[model samples]
Target chain A: MDIQFEPLQKRRLDQAKWAYTTRRINRDQNFQLLGGTLIPKAGDLVLARVDELGQHQRLELVTSRRASLYEEDEIVVVYGNRYAPDQFEGIVPDHLEPCRLVAAGGVAARLLNRHDRVKTATRITPLGLLADDKGYRINLSSARLPKAEQIDHKPLVLVVAGTSMNSGKTTACANLVKGFVRQGIKVAAAKFTGTGAGADYRALVDAGADPVFDFVDAGYVSTYRVHRDVLLDIVMTLGAEMSSNKPDVIVIEVADGLLQRETARLFAIPEFTDWIDGVVFAANDALGAQAGVSWLSARQLPVFAITGVLTASPLAQREAHDICGLPVYHTNALAQKSVSSYVYSCLKFRSQKQSISNPVREEVG
Target chain B: MTDTPQPGKIHCRTIEGMSQTNYFVYIPSETTDQRRIFYTVHGISRNAEEHIHGFIAQAERYGAIIVAPLFLKENFPHYQQLGSSATLERADMAFDHVLQDVHEWLKIPPSPMHMFGFSGGGQFLHRYAMFNPKRVARMVLAAPGWYTFPDPGQKYPYGIKSTLEWPNLKFSMEKFLQIPTLVLTGDEDDQRDKDLNKTRKIDCFQGLNRIERAERWTAAARALGRAYNIPTDFKMESIPNASHAYESYLAHPPFAQQIFDFLFEAQN
Candidate 1:
């Protein structure tokens, strides 16, 4: 059970601290040393060695100068997994043999698989050090990795947002959902951003959204700082959750303006575009309607309809149709059955496309 | 001395008057309440509740009592009849109803009032003021349709141009200036208000460099007052960042406060 430790490599170090200042390197599952403390204060080189014990690991460093004093919590090495130091040497699993190591600068280090032994090294760059700290010790096996399960027969729908906040987006979305429900379409709705009050979700529920969830339900008070990747992950996770309900349609509403940074980032991401099917632009007046259509069209997002508060006026409705050149419905008008029929025809076209592309598989054999 | 009635108390009374409109009486809070009585005309939307809310929010600090009558679309038929087109007829009916309700509530004669209009409401306020100038203490004409005095030998009723029909019966400044009026329009309002080049079209002697439609309307009112030998208390003010919807004016505290100061400070 002797655990083998590898010196940090330059490539691994560069990858470890991508866009971050500090990095952490751990030994034997426990004790950790920061690169900022162990490396040279100003361009000095350092060589660090890993020693294996029966059940613990240790690091011995040789530097051109005495190690610099560093405060705790300062990022030392960007990429190193933690391990228990008590059983350090013995814990290096028996799977990763012939490891090779690399490092960039003194910031990070890594170990890679060599022919028969672990080789460790480092490379320096302004971006930081790459570390192959964990040399290829044949101890860890991929056979223990978990497999991803296949999901069967899930329905998906896209939710579009307006370019401004409180532009009747949620109301239009709810009414559209209601229109679908009246024709026996079971629907689920979800909100993308963890911002603003839950007025839209409440309206959706009233409009017959069988299952509704907002970003708040996803355990976020706000998505202000949530990265695009994390946001897409949350959306996909919610989509998976909605799939369990077996909805005929899923309507998602984006909070905030479409040009908002978070929204732009989300829309720009390829995965998000793939998941989102149709786009709806909600606006307050004719000008906003026109602007929204132009902005979304530039981004190549599919716009299915334009709806909002201004729909209360016949002139605005007509102007919106003329300007945006899209099927337009006012919230009040959509409440009527004739308008609801038109909305259903649009949804039916979408539903037919979905059925054709992805025939709902009952189960994975 | 024992029989002298208190000025602020409103006495309840019923009447079998001949009128097709329902009027709500708003009694002033006190005898010292010199704030002008505000008569609000409902828009074609016919949401009296919303109009009342807007007026209350705008006029609360002024201690103004606002009387509004709800006239259904069916009763008014078109926007013109309910708005500025039939000025004298609508005014007579609206004022009579307001006066009767107020008299019943205050148990006194009809007092001088202020008039306010919103979209279509502005249309009614403009014509009502013309039909009965002596009744209005001050007026706020917001986003009204185009108006003009009748030409000689033209035989146009009330001196308005015959060919000038407002889109959706929403009038403009030419009509608003005949009386001392404050015009309020949003800064980012659509092309209609902006294209009028309101500053040059209306006489804005009092407001130089204030090139807003609302300011132009006020300037025209001021010029009309000066030319007609009426006291030149006319003023024009703009809601810095508003549009034709009047939302900005409603939201800005200083705008509301200034309006109160202009309307009531003159009265005291």
Candidate 2:
């Protein structure tokens, strides 16, 4: 049997639904195709066909919109890992064999585990890897934003972390962004850690945050199992880029919960904590809020306020308030000007108080 | 048989790029090799000439150079508050630039300078010290309408807390408290006139009048200094029979003397 060769064309590549994870790739550079023998790496661009539709029926596109996915529909996605305890646990497959669409943001990986309620992930068959004219595999890492120069005028870094996924971290962050916007303050937001997803990014933009970014923009389809230094570099690089825009404050939301492996390691590193001005812990219940605050406090991290699902309940809010000694605010209330002003002032105060340099006395005649 | 050295001439300078307005500088005839710079900021009255004239005697006695940067109402409407809005240039930054230009023009190296602000100037000088504590050797705030207290509890322009408009604004209590300071107000300067900042917030936190505000600020600052374990020379003097008028109080007995003694004659 003779193997037929199909040369990649601009029209053909454009016809495939481009995933959000490959949004940064220069479409014009993808002029060739490499498949079969090449081992797929995390962030490597892959043109695949939808084999079966299951949990995710739609694909988030490069335009930040969702497009319905059909069986046999050709799609362009990234090879990466996904860590969602509520949904699925998946990792990059070693070969060009079939894989699962672990995330709607367009991640193709081998399924490792899944939550009891989550259906089997949508399956995809690898057609080939997009390549340049030189046959170099086009990877998302190659399209990452360049690291910016160190900014002398640093911004106040406010982190929003939760007890776990669905603990209302994104909602709290969006509300905070909205509040700052309503207050006429220039606020830049970023998701420092998370699987490549446009939901959080779009929410921030819709809430009036300019220059919003996520781990994908930092060249990662998923931050799970990534090296600590690489994660630190993402933060430093993204921070410099955000600071270049000169926002009054940069609100970074670390995905998942405090106990998450990556978040736990990040909080323990002084390089990370010292760079942060304050933290806003999001929890689902009063006990969770209390424990999260204690965990942050033990790391000597300044947790300014308690906000998340717990804020939805007055009783929970009161209970958390009683033990945490921190203001418990409904995530929606964060959109109020007064509340945002209070939060902004608190963060600014903390930044100043924490940055007080040692005194060097000079004699005056 | 004696000739009085030419009474020091007040030189009017308009450093290009400093501001459209001119600032006055007076150089004493009897100059020392390492002469100190004395910057006297005027209040809302924008009386730069009066400040230069009022402090000439002290400048001469101390062999210091006097600089009075005229913060014109048109150019620096919010100089006292150090406003950093779209319309209002950062007065602290503008004034710092002026100080640098003045030092360069005078052929003197940049060093800590003594500052005395009268009324509106008092407001600028104190806040300036808070922002750049290392640049001030000693300071005298004479009858400012209100003060930014050393309290971290209140926000900026009221307390020492930083603001978004000025994110780089950092106030180290331990360091700023090290600078010798004197707060002067008149016994008759308790009027709540239109010039006074009578906002509810100011009146509640500071006092209703200039004298009360001065005393409160002094006490609060001294307390902070003590808490920081730093020797504080923060002092306040109430001039007798003097109103809010700068010219009247400047000549009042012990007024100029007290300023000179604190700024120049005090022992470290």
State which candidate has the highest lDDT.
2
Candidate 2 is scored at a TM of 0.58
Q: Which runs in model 2 stand beyond 4 Å of their true positions?
A: A1-6, A148-151, A357-365, B1-268
Q: Candidate 1 regions off by >4 Å? A: A1-156, A194-196, A351-365, B1-268
Give the per-residue lDDT digits (tens) of candidate 2, residues B1-268. Answer: 1222243788776655645656888878786434467788999999899888887877777787788999878777888888755235677777767777776676675558788999999999999898888988899989999988775545677875555764534566667888999898988999998889899998865778998888778877765453333578898988898899886797686787688787876532
* lDDT score at residue A58, model 1, on the 0-100 scale: 16
Tens-digit lDDT track of model 1 for B42-137: 655665555556655444545566567666554454433334444423435644665766656545456566666665666566656654566666
Model 2 steric clash total: 0
Clashes of 1: 92
